[model samples]
Target chain A: MDLQLIDQFAKNIIFEAGRRIRTAFTYDLVVETKSNANDLVTNIDRETELFLIEKIKSFDSTHKIIGEEGMGEKVDSLEGVVWIIDPIDGTMNFVKQHRHFMISIGIFVDGIGKLGYIFDVMREDLFYAIEGVGAWYNDSPLRKLQPVKIEEAVIGINASWVAPNRHIHHEKVIELVRKVRGTRSYGSAAMEIAFVVSGKLDAYVSMRLSPWDIGGGTIIAKEVGAIATNLRGEGFDFFHQDTFIIANPSIHQELLEKYIVQYD
Target chain B: MDLQLIDQFAKNIIFEAGRRIRTAFTYDLVVETKSNANDLVTNIDRETELFLIEKIKSFDSTHKIIGEEGMGEKVDSLEGVVWIIDPIDGTMNFVKQHRHFMISIGIFVDGIGKLGYIFDVMREDLFYAIEGVGAWYNDSPLRKLQPVKIEEAVIGINASWVAPNRHIHHEKVIELVRKVRGTRSYGSAAMEIAFVVSGKLDAYVSMRLSPWDIGGGTIIAKEVGAIATNLRGEGFDFFHQDTFIIANPSIHQELLEKYIVQYD
Candidate 1:
């Protein structure tokens, strides 16, 4: 497959989707409860996702999709050409703050991500990657991610892990938090993962992430020589919901093997 | 005092400072160590603050200045007219991510915040307020913040509060964390407080905050009829450092009275 063509298609579709989202955001969004009361989805999320799916379908009818809002085609596996998307990654942010969210799109073939794009609609920033060509922010090619020690690293993880939670060992996570030079949580997994890929964040770990959550960012991260894997240091199943720890290749294995708790 | 003139002058200086900071962000910034190694400051922060201080001095020579990074004159009390400034309120974010930071400046006279401005430089967003003219985003005047229940509200807090901390009773903060609809931590005190003022965040809490950290936001929050105070729901020293908790009028009392652990 032509990676450049894929990147071009992905970037165009994502930015077009972002424009739709930006327009929707101008008015009072029609926000509704989803999954749980706390989890929210505005009409913009569904609308943007549907728009992207339609646009992508027009380009390639055989392509499959896995979307955050269940608006895209349901795929059983990552086989063949699959497009994973989170039209509006940070729904709550979009609904409330009208900023800090993005439109994420990733194209993969045979379980390998070939193209990734994350467009910060409000900021007009587009971070994209074509496998082996390195990542690009706006139009500038991103540099190779340098390895940094955990203590000197600026990490990104949600506060849920630090609090008492059933997903992971909180105490151990606390140790890692204190050990890191600093920690930040932006409330958007895709954007946070993009930060890791761009070398802004040394590492990012989170539990309960869907395939659509990190797909685009994961591809970009890999292109920059970073690692995106499950907490167990095993390959992630891009078809189902799972936990992930994406970081620089130098620290990925050590972080998973030494710190990430597997069985509670 | 002419509140409109103050508002215009404050907004102009902040926007100009924001332009400089935004331009500096285009290239790789020289990140430097500040009070501690983990605490960061870049040339952008100092330069931005200096730019504001110089402009403010030219605007109103009678005003005493209290600025972060020590660029302004020493301010002891909020007597006469005072300008409290944090040129780049989210220094860490600016240094690392090159975004999510802002230029926060508040005008106080007779210990009362009269005008406030918080400019998200990268996005070209200007959130400003006059004493009674109400807050605004760019050109649109902000609506009065609506009341939100704690269980349905999105809270902005430092992620550290979820872990063991001294200033706030960690256990209570954790309980509140779970009770809230969602929690977000942007790592920028000024931005976080501005979100509260804008009603994007229902509430915001900080274990330790300096005057410059909350000054501009407090002014804006007050203009929107939001409440700003120390965690204990008591008088806050605008010149001295203390814990902070700002929220919509609906939840401010409840949060501080019940969840906040005041350190005597």
Candidate 2:
């Protein structure tokens, strides 16, 4: 498989998808609640997913596709050349803020990660990585994350983590909030993960993230020498929602051992 | 007082201050902790304050200035033409993320807000308001805020408010987080306030914000037909720090009554 050729092909499709999304913004968006109030889906999200899936199929009809909107092939397991796509990762933000949302795509071959892409549609920043090659932020190369002191490290975290919640020990999370240099909640997992890879955020913690939500970010994160794992310090399971902690190599373990507590 | 002239003058100085801040990014930053680890000050922050003060003083030496770095005259009261300046709001972001930080200036005469400005230095998006005139986002005019449902309203808030903290009832804050459409913590009060006025955020809440921290944002908020007051719905005290809630006119009262609980 010509990975370089595939990279170019996918990037073009991603940019085209982004164009359609921006075009949708010109008119009134048809938005509806999905699952719950926090989860929303706009007409753009569904349209973008279908566009990506169609583009992928035209390139290679044999490739399997799993999408956030479930617009394409029903993907149960990672088999063959599979593409996991989230046309609009931050749908709530898209429906409300009109910014901070992204288009994320992860490609795998026979259950192994191969290529990934994340695009900040509004900011027009594109980040991508190929296995054993490198990660690039637009035209510049992304440097490996430098170890930062936990005391001075800035964290991109969900505010709900510090509040009383069923996921983690809110108290432990609160302690981490005070001990860190500062806390930011951008309301987008893909964007926050992009920030971590770019060194804008030293770490990012999300109690629950879907495969489509983090699949692409985790791939870019790996090339930048950052770690994206579960609370158990294990690798990501690509088919289900689970806890996620992606951070600079130096602080990943400490964040897990000290702060992230699960009810065993 | 020719408020339009002052607005143009202040906006120009703000752009110059922003240029100096970008110049400092090319060199090493001299960072120091202020009241606590979370509170930080940098050489650029201090220098920018001095630069703005010097420019304002040259324009009118009688203009009393109160800056975050205390580089200007001691301002005991909001008398004469007082400039409340936070040369670099969100200094931690300036030092760490190198983004999201802003320069905020609020001008007052006889304790009445006359003109206000907030500049997102990196993004170069300048927001300013002239009393009884209007607010502008760059070259475009800002529209008055429309009422949004609390269930669908996105809020700009500090994460600490939801954590166990000294200021307000943390539990009540957690409830507010769940009730809103979304919660965003940008790490800068002024930027959050600008977001509120621009309608990117439906509301902004901060406990223990100083006069300089909120001075500029409150003025712009007022111009956009939003309300900025304490949790108790009282006016901001320009001389001291206290709880603050800036929101669209439709939901301000409900937010104070329904969620923000203060312990007696």
Candidate 3:
């Protein structure tokens, strides 16, 4: 397969999908409840995902899909080329904040992320990356990431992790929070992962994440010399729900071993 | 006093300051530490603040100033007109993330926030409010805020508050965290407050904040029918450090009474 051809194809479809979202921005969206009343899904998410899935299938009929809103082909394994898409990451931010959200899509072949694209619809910024080729922020190639220590790093973590929760120990998370320079949570896991690749944030950690959330970002992170792994410092399964910790190469091992330990 | 003339003057100066920041974006910035090595201060912050101060002084030398970087005149009282400026409210965000930060300036007369201006430098979006003329985003006048319930509302808060801490009761904060529809922490107090006025975020809470950190946002919040008060639901003193909870009219009182009671 010509890698450049795949990259160009992925970029075009992603931008087309973004245009669909942009057009639907002016419409009155019907927001329905997903997990709960608070967890929201607007009509835009469904329509955008459908647009992407249709376009991807036309481009390569054999490819599989894993989509956030469940509008794509289901696969039990990442045996073939799979497109993981979150039509609109940071849905809460899109609904409430009306900004700071993006559309993320990842092209992976046999469980390996090949291309990642995150489009900030409102701002018209497209952050794209091809494996082995560098990441780009609106056409400017991203610089190779410099390794930084945890104490000097700015991390992205939801307040839920530090708050009393079932997934992880709050006290250990607090210790990590205090040790970091500062913390930020943008309400979008995809954007946070993109930030890690761009070197804007040194790391991003979360207790709960789906394959559609980090699949694209994992490819982008690796291109910029970052690491995407589980809390246990193991390879993440691209077809299942799991805990994610994506960080700069310098601190990736240190974080997994020292900061995040499995607690029953 | 010509409020219209002052508004125009403030707006022009702010836009100019923003332009100066944009010009420096492509250059290699000389970054230095302020309070500690971890606390970053970019040359852009100092340059922008200096530009605003000089412009404001050229416009009116008699106004006292209280600036975050200590470059402006020391403000003892709110007698006469006092300008509280945080050239870049989220300096860390500016230094690290390069987005999600704002240039905030609040004009107070006799200790009352008379006018507020928050310019999102990167996005070229401006949010401003006069004492009674109502608030605006860019040239369009913002609508009066709609009522939001806690369970239906999205909140902006510092992730630190959710973690175990000494200043505020973390457990109670966790209850608030879980009770809200969703929570986000963007790392900029002024911008967070601007979101409150824009009806994007239903509320914002911070434990340790200085006057300049939130001065501009309070005025904008007030003009949009939101309430800005201390955690105890009392009048806020704009010159001293305090715990702020700005929110929609419906939930402001309930949040304060239920979760944020201050006791000796």
Candidate 4:
């Protein structure tokens, strides 16, 4: 497979999606609640997803797509070429702040991760990876992530994960928050993961995230020698929602063992 | 006082300081640990502060200055025309990420906030206010902030406030975190307050912050109908470090009464 070509194609599609998103922001958005009030879906999100799916289909009809807005095919397994798309990863941020949101696309072949692209629509920062070739932030190639001790690390984690919530023990997470150099919550999974890859943030932890949320970021982070896993320190499932902990290789295990507590 | 002219003058100084900061990022930095390992100060921070102080002193010799880097006069009170300066608000962010840090300058007349300026140096976005004339984000005028309920508000709060630490009760803060729509920690009080003023964030709560951190933001937020007070719902002390809660008027009292637990 021509990974470079595929990467370029993905970047073009993402940039196009970003343009559409930018245009949509100027006009009044027709927003609707999805699942819950906090889980919002704007007209722009659907439109961007449809546009991406159409581009993907025209590029390769045989490729399967799993999109956040349900505009693509429902694949049972990653058998052939699979594309995971999150039109707007931080839909709430998009609707509320009109910034900090992203369009993420992850491409896989026969269950093997290949190319990925994450575009910060407003910032116009394009983060992409071509399997083994390496990840690039805009025009420059990203360096491998450096190891960081827990005390010296700045982790990206929302307060939700550390509060008395259903997913993890709030107290243990609090301990982790205290131990780290600092904590930041941008309310966007893909962007936070991109920060980790770019060395802006040392780690990102969340109690629940969808495959589309982590798909693109996972590939980009892996290219820079970062690790992505569930709270249990296991590999992510490409078809289900799971807790995510993407961090530098040096502290990933330590964070999981010390902070992340999963109740069976 | 000519608030508008002072606003413009402050803006120019901030922009110039921003330019210096940007140029400094290109060269190797001389970083020194301050109070602790996490408390950092860079040569750039001190240099930027000195530059701003020179400009302020030259612009108006009669003006009193209070600066984070200790470059300005040590005024015992907010008398006369006072200028509170944080040359680089998010010093750690500047040292680590090279973005998100800002230059914040707050001007006052006889202890009353008269004008303010906060510039995101790397992004080149300026957020400033001219007393009665209202706040401007870049060249665009900012609208008055709309009210948001606790359940629908995105609050800017660091994880330290909710963890087992000094200042506030961790349990109550955790409850507030659970109830709010979401929480974000950007690690810069000025930027967070700017977010609150711009309606990107509904409120910002910090257990400890100095005058330089909140001075400029207070002026801007107040113009947007947001309220700035201590966690105890009292006014801020311009001469000392204190807990702060800057928020929309509608939710300010409620958040203070319910969430912010001041440990006597």
Q: Write the per-residue lDDT of candidate 3 for residues A1-264, one digit (tens) a residue.
A: 666887888778777877777787788878888988866899988988888888888988998888999987667887788888898998988887777888888887887778888888888888888887688988799887997988998898887788767777777778888899988888888889989989999999988789888878888887788899888778786667899999999988887776665576
DockQ of 2: 0.67
Interface RMSD per candidate (angstroms): 1.4, 1.5, 1.3, 1.0
Name the runs in model 2 displaced over 4 angstroms: none
Candidate 4 lDDT, tens digit per residue, B32-140?
A: 9999988899999998889888888898899999999898777998889999999999988988888888889898899888888888898899898888889889989
Q: Across residues A148-247, which tens digit of lDDT does each residue of candidate 1 receive? A: 8877887887777788888777887777777777777777888888888888888888888888888888888877888998887777777677889999
Assess each prediction's global lDDT (C-alpha) against the native.
0.82, 0.88, 0.84, 0.88
Clash count, one per candidate: 0, 0, 0, 0
Please report, as a residue range, the 10-residue window in candidate 4 chain B with the lowest summed lDDT.
Answer: B1-10
Task: Assess the local accuracy of residue B94 in candidate 4 as a C-alpha lDDT between 0 and 100.
Answer: 89
Q: Candidate 2 at A162: error in angstroms?
A: 2.2
The lDDT of model 4 is 0.88
Model 2 C-alpha lDDT per residue in residues A1-264, reported as the tens digit of each score: 888888999999999988888888899999888898788888888889989988999999999998999898678888789999999988877876678899999999888778988899987889899888899999989999988999989898877788878888888988998888788888889989988988999999988889998889888998999999988889888888989989999999999988878767
TM-score per candidate: 0.95, 0.95, 0.96, 0.98
Binned by DockQ into CAPRI classes (incorrect, acceptable, medium, high), candidate 4 is medium
Model 4, C-alpha of B158: deviation from truth (Å): 1.4
lDDT, candidate 3, B1-264, per-residue tens: 787888999999888888888788889988899879666898888888888889889899998889988898767888998999999888888878788789899998888888999999999999999988789999889888998778787888877777766666777778888888788788888888888899888889887688888889888888889998887777677668888889999999888777655544
Candidates' DockQ values?
0.62, 0.67, 0.74, 0.76
**Predicted candidate 1 versus true structure: per-residue lDDT over B119-193, tens digit per residue:** 888778888888776888888998888989989888887667777866767788778878887888787888888
